[model samples]
Structures are given as C-alpha cells and as structure tokens.
Target: MNVTTILLIFLLGAVLTYVSGNKLASKIALGFSIMAALASFYLLQLYLANQNISFNGVWLQSPKVFLSLQADGISLAMVLLTTCLMPVIVLSSFGNIYNNAKSFYSLVLFMAFAMTGTFLATDGLVYYVFWELALIPIYFIALIWGNGSIESRKKAILKFFIYTLAGSLFMLIAFAYLYTKTGSFLWNDLVKLNLTSTEQTWIFLAFFLAYAIKIPIIPFHTWQAKVYQKAPTVGTMLLSGIMLKMGLYSVIRWQLPLAPLAAKTYMPYVLALSIAGVIYGSIVALKQKDLKKLLAYSSLAHVGLIAAGCYTLTQDGLSGAIAQMIAHGFVIVGLFFAAEVIYRRYDSYKIKDLGGIRSQTPKFSSLFLLLVLASVALPGTYNFVGEFTVLFSLYQINIWYAVFGGTTIILGAYYMLKMFQNVMLGETNTKAFADVNWTETFVFVVIIAFLLLYGLYPKPITDLVTPSVKEILTIINR
Candidate 1:
C-alpha cells in the first residue's frame, strides 16, 4: 500500500507488457492498468485514514536528493487520476490496431509509470526526473505510431517535443536555483526559505514558462492543435486526458506555494492571459472544421479557466481546479474517443461530411450528446460543479474576471452543441455505421457514470481535496 509499491506496479507492468509479445500485449497492459488503478483506490483509502503510504531513500548523497515518493491528500487525488484514466485509455484502444502492437501498448504503460511517479515524487529532483521521463515514451508513441502524413506528423511531433522540452529547461533552471538557496531538493526544505521578492518573481516565471506551455495558456498554446490533429487517438487521449493536468497540478503543487508573492504580484497579468486563452480557444473551436483540432481548442478553453482558478489562490479556486482536472480528464477522453470512432468509419475528420449520424446510430448519438452536454457544463454534471465554483472564486477577486470567464459556458455550448449537430445530427451518412461495441460501451459507461455520480455529490471529493488546498493557501497567504 506504499506509494513506492504503486510506482513499482506501473513500471513493472510496463516492462512485463513489453515482454508479453504481440498477442498478449494489449490484454497484459489493460489488466495491469486496471490492477494498478484498483490498488491506487485502496492506497487512497489508506491515505484518507492517515496511513503512511510513503517511502524515502538517499539516492544522491552529494546533491542530497532523495528518491522520495509520498502520497498525501493532494498527491493521492492526482495518483488516482493517473491510474483511473489509464485503464480506460487502454480499453479505448482494445478495438483499434497499430503496426507494432507491443511497442505502442508498452509505451502507454510506460507513460502511466512516468505520470504516476510525477504525482508521487516528494523530492524536487525526483519530481523533475519523473517530469521529463514522461516525455520520452510519448515522443516515440507519437513519432512512430501517430497518424497523418509521415512528413506532417514528423513536423507536428517535433514542434511538440521541442516546445515542451524547451519549456522544461526553464523549470530546471528554477529548480537548480532553488537547490542553491536551500542546499536541498526536498519540498519541506524548499518551502522554508526566505527568498527576496525579486528571486521569487524569477522562480515564478521559470515555472510559469513550463506550465503555461503545458496548460497552454494563450500565446504559449500554438503546439497543441497541430499535435492533437497529428497524433493518434490514444496519444491525443494521453495528452489531453492526463498530461495537461501535469501542468495544472504543478501550478497548485509547486508554483503558487513556492512563489506566493510573485504569484500575487503577477495575478492581474496571469488572469488576463488565462482568460484570453479561454475566449481565444473558444472562438477558434467555433470555426474548426476538423473534429480533433476542435476538441483540442475546446480542451485549451477548459484548462484556461482551470489555470485561472488556480491563480486565484483561494480554497474554492484551488479545490475547484482539482475537481475540474478530474472532470475534464474523463470528459475529454470520451470526446476524443467519440471523434476517433467517427474517424474510423468515415476516414475523415472534416465536420462537413459528418452528418445525421443520430438518424443511423441512436445509441451513439445519445451517448455522444450526453458527453457533449457534460462538456458544456450542463447542470447535474461534474463539470458544472467545477465551473461554478471556479467562477465564484473569480468573482471574489474581480467581478469582471468572472464575467469574461463565464463566456465559456455560453461559447462552449455554442461550439460543442454545434459540433454535435454537425457530427451526430445532420443528414444520414452514406456509409454504414457501427455503434459502440462492448469495449467502447465500457469506456463511455464508466465516464458517464462517474460524471453523474460526482456531479450529484461532489462533497466527497471536495472534502478530500479541501485540506490540501487550504494548506497551500496558508503558504500563499503567509
């Protein structure tokens, strides 16, 4: 039940999956991911009971960095996220085919391993190590197995790789500076330093550069659409479903807590940028004819508000951001999977050709419409709960911020509903269509059920995340 065990399971599972050979690879990966997820829930229960599901060892004596993996309330939430989405991600691929099945599935498990370590690492160096470790498997996954013309995919993936890698370097610099200040890379030690306002500002920007590129708040988001369009459905799922949360989670876990003064000083500008991303992504999504690209912009808009909420530095804001992260993770995966299903049948992503699918496949259309409504933050859905709380937090700081941020509700509905109309509701497609098979049904059912259950009763999650959010707020307000 230790955090170390959780990491080991995913890593071991990944290696075993690679060795499982082609026939058994996907099953091994799926089984391993599910086992890890259920085990994570057990560990989460232990964590909630105040058990010590943590491990630490001296990995580098000279640098004084520890290979520490600890699960707290916050980390537990994130670890659970990484585990929960992983199985569904794997299951979503059960019906698809790839040239090198073993390599592709192994990469998925490896990506989960990296992401799990990222959430569980307590040492700054280890966290950074895990952070970059995540990029490797995904790079190959997209580069080797991704979709689109070979040349076009190559350009898209390289831009994505370079953009994120370049941003990560700035974060490395900041962490290096932090180690110099504290003589240690431990979270506890780093949090105790009394740095000057200027130093904090620099550190804040260093972290901001990395996170902004990932959460991809305006101007810094150019890499996303092309990458999403080019990558395979599974790669796109990994990116939007969970990888984006790495940045949003870091904002709560590292940035604001470490550089409170800088965060406060720069709040106005950050809000403007984040809110601008909200409007910009929404408007662009409104015009996108390509389904995958449209979903990417939609993700950008949703996460922009999540980033804005984190910057608010309030209990409601931070906690709401975490909830939204979970909600968006599920909703986006389902949406992208829906896009993939449509693409499989038509071999095209252009919205114009996707017409009157509802007339043919009522079951898929109904399911898709439900997910679309959830995405638009319809009442009684988890997204609505997250969105409302975040907007309320924004209103506490500035009424106008909430007003502009609120446009997502209106514009989000406009685009998602319009896309639904175009893709699922128009003229009946000329090609015969197949609805969700058992595996796809399992994926959608899990997503729909969780969103509904949580949407109706968010108190459990709110309670779980509140203490951690409040602790971070205490550091920020100090």
Candidate 2:
C-alpha cells in the first residue's frame, strides 16, 4: 500500500468513529488507530525493501498542485511517531469519561490525519494545508472540553490560536513567494532555487516565524504552559507528543534546505536562542506548581535542545533531533498520563494536594519513577541516546554551546526529581490513592519498554535516519 492508504485509514476512522455513537466511539477509535499503526509498519517494510511508498496525483489544475505524498526514512519515522502514539493517546483516555465522547474521539483521529499528512506531504501547498488543518480539531478540543474556568480557558486557547495562525500565514506567504520564484511548490523544485542572500534571509525568517511559534521557541512560547494546563490530557498528549515535532521536522525538511545560506548565517544566533530557551524553560519549570504546566515547560526545554540540534546543521545533530523527537513524544505522553492517573484518583493536579502515592500505589509509583527517570534522560533510557548525541554535536560546534545546552540534563534532573518527590512520595495522605488499573499499566509498560529497548540499542533508529540526514545535510551545504 502507498502512503495515501495510511491517511485514508485515519480519515475513514474519524468518520466511522463519529458515527459509531458514544458507546462505540472509543473502541472504534482505538481499533482504527491500531490499524493505522499496522498500516504504517507495513509501509515501513515496503520502504526497507526499496519500494516506493509515495503517492502522486494532480489535485488542482489552476495552481498545478500535485497530491504528492513522499516517504523517506525521516518522514516515515515521523509517521510512525504519529500513528503509533495515536492508539496510546486514545487508550490512555479509557479511564476518564468525557461529555460528547464521540466528538472528542473523532477530533483526536482527525488531528492524527492532518499530522500524518503533514509528515508525508512533499508539495509545499499540500504540506501547508495539512499543517493548518491540524489546528482546527485542537481548537475545538481545547475550547469545548478543556479544563479551568470557561473564560480563562477561552482566553488561553484564543491566544494560542491567533499566534499560531498568524505565524502560519507568514509561512504561507513564504511558500507563495517561493512558488512564484520556482514556478512550482514541489520539494525538489523549491530546493533547487538559488535565491539572493537577502531573499533567502526573508524566506528563512518567515518559515522560522511559523515554526518558532508552533515550536514556541523562547519568546514565542508564552501561550504553551497555560494551554497545556487547560487542555484535556489527551489534547496535551497530542500537542506535546506529536504536534511539537512538526515544527522541528519542518526545520530540517523545509527551512534549512530552502535557505541554506540563511541557515549558515544565522546558525550561531539560532543556536544561542535555542540554548537560551533550554535554560529558560528548565528554570521556569522549576517554579511550576501544577503538574501539567511543569511538564509543559519541561517540554519546552527538551524541544529547545532538539531545535538546537537541527540548527547545528550536522549529521549527528539532525539525526539526534529526530531521535529525540520520537523519544520525547512517547516519554511526554507517559508523563502526562501519570498526571492524569493522579487526577483520576485525587481529582487534582496541584503538587500541594498530591503526596504519599508511592506508599499507596506501588505499581503506579514505580512506573512513574521510570517515566520520570526517562524524562531526566537516565543513562539507560531512550532519551539519553538522543540528549547525549545532541549535546555532543553542540560541543563540537562550541564547548559553551554544550555547556549551556547541558543545563537541560542538570536542571531537568533537579526539577523532575523534586516534582516526583512532592507528587509521588512523602507520608501517606488521608485520601487513598488507588493503584493503576490494567489500562494504565499497559500504557506505562509499552512506553517504558520502548524507551529502555531503544535506549540500550539505538542502532536501528540511527541506521534508518542516517541516510536521510546525510541527504538533507548535503542539500544544506551544497
């Protein structure tokens, strides 16, 4: 099957889930998500066998846009991240019931469809369309189903929507400008233009603005913590786990190759900004009293490092960024699920209200400890492989870069450990904390196993991503 099949599966699953009614929506959504995962793995098999898994067709006559979906190791890795995590995201919600379950579940699958299309689309216009499509579902999901007072949640979600939308328009203008220059928006065509340094700089900043707001790098990240706290856990998972990677992926896929000189010219400043974000996010996370917000800031720190790796413009940096994207996706989901597990029993997310859970729920505490350890990038976890490689690349560029970037690990460990201590440990509380049920245990097991397995042996991921990273680097340096 071609890559289009995977997109169709999600789209179809979304439609079917919505019509299935509340009773079956969750089950149907979970089933379709698993099917999409299987389809993606099969697609990977085809890719490994040297088969073309891409789809190309004409979608419009006037603009001459082709419905192009390209698959390479890099894109497939991202696709796997989206599809695989989808089931986990859906399953993670089984413990909590929502009003309008069908609509909620449907939006979840629809967001997956858009994100998958974003990863696979090769035409600039097609990619932009998919990117914008993703925002719609999350908007409704957060606005209608999110936590907190109605007015506050509305304010947070609205600010996020406007910021992202405005930034995306800049990217659209960039793509439109590039289309005029190249007479095409295909990936191959856009990458071939030899624009003036001035042209490249403008184009680069436009795309950077789009990705930066989405990635929410540094100053652009104001909306993140509040929104992450306000959104439902599943919405947060989709945002943190898979959605954040889109901007990082776009940096490598669209930004650098299209404006290599701009990338080179700005690399130092970009790296500095990214490292600044790492330090800033980590420090901010240290003071967060809410569990989800703390995790949100921590996500900012981790992704800052990943963005730094991307701008390093080296093979190790690019590959490590992708690895960390995948690693962070799973680990963050598990971490958020841990918060949800607590909320399930205690009806709260405040660190002040939580404690003594380690004594009451040994299974949950042990699993959460593993997740926290993974978050801190413990030596034997998947995060370590990604973090180490990214930092090592920074060290090669400048020891100071590594020194500043390394704060993520040190500062990260401090905040994470402290948060864990306050939330999961301490004297037993009067309120009894229940152990994780089968669904929660299954989710934790899957995430931890993947992290440990890949942490110990990252060769498969390394091999898969290396060739693609090399190609992108060559394009950047050409």
Candidate 3:
C-alpha cells in the first residue's frame, strides 16, 4: 500500500529466507520476489497517477535528522528495475545452487531490500546508510560461494569491499560538509542551500571519487575483473546488473543537480575519462582468456559509455544513459548466465578449453548468440537503441567523442564474435558436453524476449524516463 509497507514485506522475506531450509529457500525467495515485483508495479502505477509520494517525520530533531522516503519518476524507475530483476535472478539461480541455499536466498532478498531503500530514501544520511548497507550481503555471497579457490574468492571479495568502502568514505565526508552548510540532512534542504563555488567543487570531487569507483572508471577498475571472475554467477549478476547503477543514479540525483556549476566546469575531463575507460576496457577484454573476466571488462566498457552520457549534461544523454543502464543490466545478466551454462557443462571458462558447443547445444548456442549480439548492440535488440541514443547525444557534444565511443561497437563485435566462434563454431570436441536444460532455456528465452520487445518498442520506457530527464535538465539549467 505504501513504501514502508512494501519495504517491510521485503525485510520479512529476508528473515524468512534465512530461516528456511535449502529445499524451500529458493521457492520462498522467488515467491517473495514476485510479491515485491507486484508491489513495485502497483507503486509505479500510483506514482504515474499522482506524480510523487513522500513520507517525512523528525526521527531525531536534535541533529536535524529526518526519516524521509520519497519516490519520483527516477527513483520509481530504478525501483521497478530492482523489483523486476530480483525474480529473474532468483529463478536463474535455482538449478545452480545447493549448499547453503537458505543463506544464499536470504542474501539475495536482503540485497533487494537494501537496493530499494537506497532508491527511495530522501535524506542524505538515510541514503548513505542504505548505500553502504547494500554492500555487506553481496560481499559475503561472493566470498562464500564464489567460483575460484577459497583464497582467490577471499582476495577478490576483500578488494571489492575495500574499493567500495574507500570511495564511500569520501562521500560520507561530502555529506557531513553539506549537513554543516544546511544544518539538515533532508534532500530538499541540502538542494536549496546556496553553496559557494569552492564548496561545491570540493563536494563534487568527493562525490565523484565515490561514484567513479563504483561506476569504476578505468584506473579505478582493477578490483572489478577479479571480483566478477570469482563471484558466483548470481552474485555477479546482482553486482553488475543492479549495484553499479546505484552509482550512476547517485551521480544524477546528487552530484549534477546539487553542484551544477562544478558539473559544467568539470564535465569535459570527466567525459574524457569515461571515453578512455571505454577504449581501455574493450582493449583489455580482447585479451582476456577467462569468460567471466572478459564479461567483466566488457561491463566496464559499457558503463563507461553510460557515464560519458551522463556527463554530457543533455536530456538525450541522460535518458540514453538510463536506457543503456536497463539494457546493459539485462544483457550482462544473460551473458553471465550463458557463461554459467557453459561452465556447468564443461567445467571451464577458459576460451581455449571450449569448442563446438553449438553442435551439441543448438538451443543454448542460439540463445548465447542472441545475447552476444545484444551485447554488441545489434539492431533489433535493446542495447542498440541505448547505444544509438548515447552516441547521438555525444555527437552533439563533440563528433570526435562520439567517434571514439562508437569504436566500442567495433571492438565489442570483435571480442564477442571471437568468443562465440571459439566456443561454438569449431569441430565438435571429443569430450562430452551437455545442452542447457528446460530451466536454463526458459530463463534465457525470457531475457531475450524482453530484449527484443524493448528494442522494437522502446517508446514506453523512453516515455517513462523522459519527464524525469527533463526535470533533471531543468535543475541543471536553472
């Protein structure tokens, strides 16, 4: 019925998931995820009818802290993305998991709850708490159930935890500064404060450090490959698919609007860094032998383009970034799932060790190919629409920038096709390999269907995001 009611339900689901046994854990998680999705859909409908919703009260008057939850078009869209993807992620994990299934499912549900809170909280302190809170369950999930040797998993998880936490500390400092300026933690209060240029610049830099590490612009990206490589596929899916977006979302929601002059003055360099990340990530991906590592680099490249779009500071760029965020979320999940399918059958993700999978698993091959094409931004897929919008917006900023960003399409095709050819097109291996079962097929097919549906008729999503994008631009231009 309301934000708190829905969040409580997810919290309850998390508790239930933890207590449940392995046999029923997945089913319980899935059921709760489905309910969360339905509740989010209802919330979206209500927001469309009413425009906005908020719940505000003094939680600690002495410190000027408030318990505030608000939903706007932007927050609602992200909420919808979180709710929509959780069920799919839960379903995808069904066959792959066994031991500690209850803990696994509980972590997943807990992640959903944290992500929703991050999206909805309107107070800066509340938002930061949710932001950091979201990371704990994922760190453990990756550390406990990840693919590599125990030491490797531990190393990867530690790197991930440290990198994100280090960035967040700077963000915490920025929020503290803002609290001093406004004497309040409320989002509106902070936004209305007339901050000096020097103050805005410093705050922007602090926020940038946090979000850059999360969006993981090039030099800061060393932790990502190892983490993605070691984490279980479900954990990888949530990290890349949902968690990364939180950084980009914050950049839009907090950085650009709150520090408009700083954003304008520093955007060119930021855009250049993003462009560098695009090229660097693609080049690095071309050399990766491990499938998970390759996808990890590719994810970095894709998000770099989205970050570039955000810095372009145009409506089309912002909207396109949102579109690409959604597109990449689905495409990366499917790509990782495809990798998981091969890994399950062959017990190897090394490109050299796999070949001629298509001969044994035509269905799996077809699905993998489609997802790969989507990753490479083929027409008639969701990624194409997002890429096109982003590139178009970049062109308005600078033709060379657009040209550099466009090279991702070429490099992407080279690496993804190379991967497909190496894995699927050679003579059948003498070693035995199994095709994906009905469950995997169902999961892959659903993702593919949504990809195509959005590709062909992206207007609905564009329409949903447009008003918010315009609102953001209004703030920037004001």
* Candidate 1: worst-modelled 10 consecutive residues by lDDT: 1-10
The alpha-carbon lDDT assigned to residue 93 of candidate 1 equals 87
Q: Candidate 1: which pairs clash?
A: 356-426
Model 1 regions lying over 4 Å from their true place: none
Indicate the residue-level lDDT of 70 in model 1: 72
- Put down candidate 1 lDDT per residue, 349-452, tens digits, no spaces: 99998898888888888889899999999999999999999999999999999999999999999999989888888688899888778778889989999999
Off by over 4 Å in 2: none
Cα displacement (Å) at residue 386, model 1: 0.5
lDDT tens readout by residue for model 3, 1-478 = 6677568778999999889888899999999999998888887787778845567777877777787988877787788888888888898887785688999899889988998898888898889999999999999899888887999899888988999999999989998989888798887777777778898899899999999988888788889999999999999999999999999999988899888889999988999999999999999999999999999999999999999999999988998899999999999998998898888877889988889889887888899999999999999999999999999999999999999999889999999999899989897777877878888888898889989999999998888889888988888787
Give the candidate order by descending lDDT: 2, 1, 3
Query: What is the C-alpha local distance difference test score of each model?
Result: 0.90, 0.94, 0.89
User: CA lDDT of 205 in candidate 1?
Assistant: 96
TM-score of each: 0.99, 0.99, 0.98
lDDT of 3 at 430: 72
